[model samples]
Target: MLDKDATEFDGACHCGAVRFHVRLSEGLHSARRCTCSLCRMRGAVAVTARLGDLHMLAGQEMLTLYQFNTGTAKHYFCSRCGIYTHHQRRSDPSQYGVNTACLEGVSPFDFEDVPVTDGVNHPSDGNGQKGDGIIGVLRFQSVGC
Candidate 1:
């Protein structure tokens, strides 16, 4: 949930062809993963952003869109580098699930653990329980520095 004190971040695609600015809905605490078919294959950690919070800075034409299943979620990636940048969430059309990796100085590995949503049985698909929707958590244990 973005408050008046929300901090803005600059982000770009791996190839630097696409750039954007965003204000997360809950800072980095919003980090999460999904268990849907597409999400499972992409394996990206996402943070929430309201539709009005994401502002494309440059190379909008270099971005590609991909959709599947219900096609309600609009996934955007950099065409030059094949990097997933963000997606309009299917369960919540008013928000986008921004790729944490796209943010400058950020990496998915930076999170020690992330909540995994039950996207496989999404509530929008008329299955599973409403609210939270968390099915599990993913933890990363580093061996050495």
Candidate 2:
């Protein structure tokens, strides 16, 4: 059952091979970018959503999962287009970190001051390795629009 009051945002992979709708639990206030080796390379802004808040409207088969390190985190992407869509956060299993850029009419650059999570020293790693702790929030404004 879908919540009538929930805000719905349409999303699709780069090649339109995968599509889905995100019914935000509380709008989109929880967007952030991670600074982990994998995340930094991927370079995508993720917003918080409960596992139930996300609904796969189509292309479930085109989605592929990838895990690394301790395999605690599950990353999902479109197998056809190779576009990362979302992932289950290792820090909070209950939260699904969604690719903010996938949202319709939304661009990572449109966001101002996005907080950076210190994945380099994740508590789950227990490696005693630590990042500077939230390097900073990035701010950007789309130009010529």
Candidate 2 residues lying further than 4 Å off, grouped into runs, are 1-6, 127-133, 141-145
RMSD of each: 3.1, 4.6
Candidate 2: lDDT of 8? 72
Q: For model 1, what is the alpha-carbon lDDT of residue 8?
A: 75
For model 2, residues 7-89, the per-residue Cα lDDT tens digits are: 57899989988899887666566778888889999999887788998899899899999999979889999999899999998
TM-score of each: 0.93, 0.86
lDDT of 1 at 121: 91
Model 1 agreement with the true structure over 28-52: per-residue lDDT tens digits: 8888999999999999999999999
